[model samples]
Target: MSKVLIIFIKNPVAGKVKTRLAATVGDTTAVEVYKNLLHHTQNITHLMAADKFLFYADFLQREDEWPNEQFIKHLQKGNDLGKRMHHALEQVFLNKYKNVLIIGSDCFELTAAIIEEAYLVLEDKNIVIGPAKNDGCYLLGMKNPQPCLFKNVSWSTSQVLQQTISICTREHLNDCLLPTLTDIDDENDLSVEQKIYFKLKKSAQ
Candidate 1:
């Protein structure tokens, strides 16, 4: 029952985070939006019943919103998204964590209940995926370190989820799919509430 949740977040820099969304909203506003998503993620995960690991895409922030007491922070070590996720999972698995899950800060639709469902699914299945629109995924969880899942796969494309599923099928892994969720990557992906919130944040700034 030793489970670990690996949350991948970028440093809240104006031009570095949420670049895709920034294309339309501008960098400062995109940073504001990403910060909101980070706070939402923190609120949902802080009370979960698992050891939380916060993987920073850039440098680690020891005095930021993610409290040191709650999140074990680490710097991401790979050049690509797939490799970084693989490295994080490998690190946690090496520590003998029975269940390991990875998530990013882009999914506003992701909630603690969905995370709990992924862990519950993993109790019976080898892999669990929370599929996102356009062939991405909001979450990926597994009981063991499966390097093949990350090998030769296209990262950040419309084929990601399908390619991973194909890998699972080829490996004969028992996999489960949770409800589909959306990762807020583009301007069109924003909800009404998020849009209003962003405007208010911009006005306040």
Candidate 2:
């Protein structure tokens, strides 16, 4: 089956990305952290078997770290997070892809293996979700477009996963749950290695 991996990312701009993490670490540091996360995401998805799509939040970037030759790029549509995600899925499904998965650039622990598992599980399931430990889901996949899953969700809140699950149950969609992972949102979520890296980054600045 043909599969597509949709990556949603914001253009790394100081004071714009990672606002919650920026509350503790300065804006510059937050941008730096976001850039690192972007690199990590690029590393994991660049070589994956599925057709990759890079969905930017604001505008299309013609030239950047993400090799244009490998990824099909587009701008994310709609106003809120849920609407944007739903729109992305709608677009991909319209293109006749058999399986589609969407991920954001916040989860450092999200690996290519996990992403592959998501696509693999869709072979028999209607949907797959990778829950972020607290904030929300890091990854979501489906074989067909399910608009209900994205509606009525409070984005960026702890209730996001539960709300999505409830929707799945209500819609009777057979869904598979992936391993819970961490999303780098709060200052407390930083790992020891990340802390050291940030410290050194500051020292070098």
Candidate 3:
């Protein structure tokens, strides 16, 4: 069975994306930053994975803007963050892939090796989580579709990782955790990590 990778991204429209960061960096800058993040994510995924898809917030009107012609681009359809992710995974599993890995664009430390490691862990574990320093997760992978792992959980909060762990425990699922990494979400979160933020800014430019 083929391994699949689903990249989750929002429309990088000014004043619509990254609202928290827009409060400090302005809408225009936030949009530009989000675009750069998408570019970086696409680059890394293209280099590492063979089967990839873009789980976009909005449907793409122009095909030229998207990278791979083989990539299956689909609009996310769900009420909340958790539901959207769950729905995306369900779709991927329905495609007959053996393992599916989903990642967000905010994480700078995410690399091809990290993704490959997650795929490797799926052989023995039911779920593999790449935890973020902010107590969230950058990546989530599973061998099968399991919506219970995402049900009724608080998203975009510091307790996100903990809540996911609780869900896994309750379901008796075997889970593997990777080393913690940082993700750029808000101004305060960036302030403490000036070096990484500036590095990303420079790379974006």
Compute the lDDT for candidate 2.
0.92
Q: Rank the candidates by TM-score, best first.
A: 2, 1, 3
User: Which regions in candidate 2 have their CA more than 4 angstroms from the true location?
Assistant: none
Model 3 Cα lDDT, one tens digit per residue, 1-205: 3899888988888988879988877776677767877877877787665588788887664464566475678888888889899888888788788788999998767888899999999999999999999999999999898889888688989999999999999999999999898787876655446546655765677
**After superposition on all CA atoms, what RMSD does each candidate show versus the true structure?**
1.0, 0.9, 3.1
Full-model lDDT for every candidate:
0.92, 0.92, 0.83
Preferred candidate (TM-score higher): 1 or 3? 1
Per-candidate clashes come to 0, 0, 0
State which candidate, 2 or 3, has the greater TM-score: 2
Residue 6 displacement in candidate 3 (angstroms): 0.6
Off by over 4 Å in 1: none
> In model 2, what is the error at residue 197, expressed in angstroms?
0.9
lDDT value for candidate 3?
A: 0.83
- Alpha carbon lDDT at 15, candidate 3: 88
lDDT of candidate 2 over 21-125, digit per residue (tens): 999888989999999999999999999988898999998998999999889999999889999999888888888997899999998999999999998899999
